[model samples]
Target: ALQRTPLQHEQSDILEQQARDEKVALEKATDQGQYFVFCDTAPLLTAVYSDFVFGDTSLYPRARELHARYAMTLILEPDLPWVADGLQRDGAHVQKPIHLKIAQELRGMGSLHYRVTGSGEARLACARAAVLAGNTHIAATGWRRTI
Candidate 1:
């Protein structure tokens, strides 16, 4: 809706709503006993955007809480050519900066994240490898039963 609507990306109300939606979806996935719930971007990313665009940190606490529920986070690098995503994206130039901000935030939160980088099938392979590696780490650390 942010893409089609006139509402600005920095709008707090919309940001809050997006965070709430993410929380609800994550909760519902958990409630449904899903073994693996793949999220394109979580509330953590929403918090990143809130801070990056609006200088708002209001969503951090809740975003961090929801972030802890994830077994691992895959930070996909913006190495590929930018495809126009309507009004949702701020173009290719900002991709690296935004990605860095997200990495910094994840580090601050002490979250487990892997940077997935490559192109085409190689990128997918990298992500799959990361998932398998993360799963191994989770199992070894006895975090397997929780997810």
Candidate 2:
């Protein structure tokens, strides 16, 4: 025997429609651009957060689908030590699982590139190196830079 979850109400349908429309716009822009556009959040992570932690799943499917359309994904490693900043944090314990889920989902998407570890200039240099490496890869593959 099987059970089924009830269909989502009108709000979820509206949100899914909005996400689809936005993804179409972004895809149009991305196709028109020369160099690549870099983004911090891959959007699917937001979907994951919404589904698992944030008590909302309305936009998850659309967001996850659009994120899979991205050319590449860079995931910053989360091995750095943390201090409670007294603001803007849910503590590392809460965040670590979310971070791991992001990594897992990104891996499932098959485009993840993990950033090198360390802090300050070391991390900065790692980021720069990743971009440079991406550029080199593009050149080697005969792709044009967008930015």
Candidate 3:
């Protein structure tokens, strides 16, 4: 059996505590009047690489759980071609699996989600319409339409 080292255990504890604190703070900060709050990477892709590299999967579940619990997720297939800055990214072809992986993760969590696809204003409009329809009972009514 591969037992976790003491340092690994400590690191996991710290990460778990940080996630708990962040959730508490976010819950406290949410205003009753607010319809939504935005998170850039709602379903964080951080663990996709680290788990591949270091076998550290502690980050994935916590991020996924928090994202699903706190927000209505919108995943955009992004109309733009993937361009790497040469410093901060994996190539687009490489990232496809990561994107699909997150979607699969969210789907397994039974999350209500929207896949927004388009360019510029059209994309924004599609997201808006999806959200509105979702919030207004499309989820309940089973009204799936191609946007």
Best by lDDT: 1
Which candidate ranks first by TM-score, i.e. highest? 1
Runs with alpha carbons beyond 4 Å of true place in candidate 2: 1-34, 54-59, 83-88, 139-147
**Residue-level lDDT tens digits of model 3 in 65-133:** 555454357877745788766454556766666678767876877767888888889988999987886
If ranked by lDDT, best first, what sequence of candidates would result?
1, 2, 3
Kindly state the number of residue pairs that clash in model 2.
5
Q: Candidate 2 — worst ten consecutive residues by lDDT sum? A: 1-10
- What is the per-residue lDDT of model 1 for residues 1-147, given as tens digits with 9 covering 90 to 100? 655423334555554565566566767877898656677767777777777766778877877876776788999998888998776776777788889988998898888789899998999999999999988888888874332
Clashing pairs in 2: 34-145, 34-146, 35-145, 35-146, 35-147
Is candidate 1 or 3 superior in lDDT? 1
- Select the stronger candidate by TM-score from 1 and 2: 1
TM-score comparison, 2 vs 3, better candidate:
3
Q: Tens digits of per-residue lDDT for model 2 on 65-86?
A: 7665555566677778868765
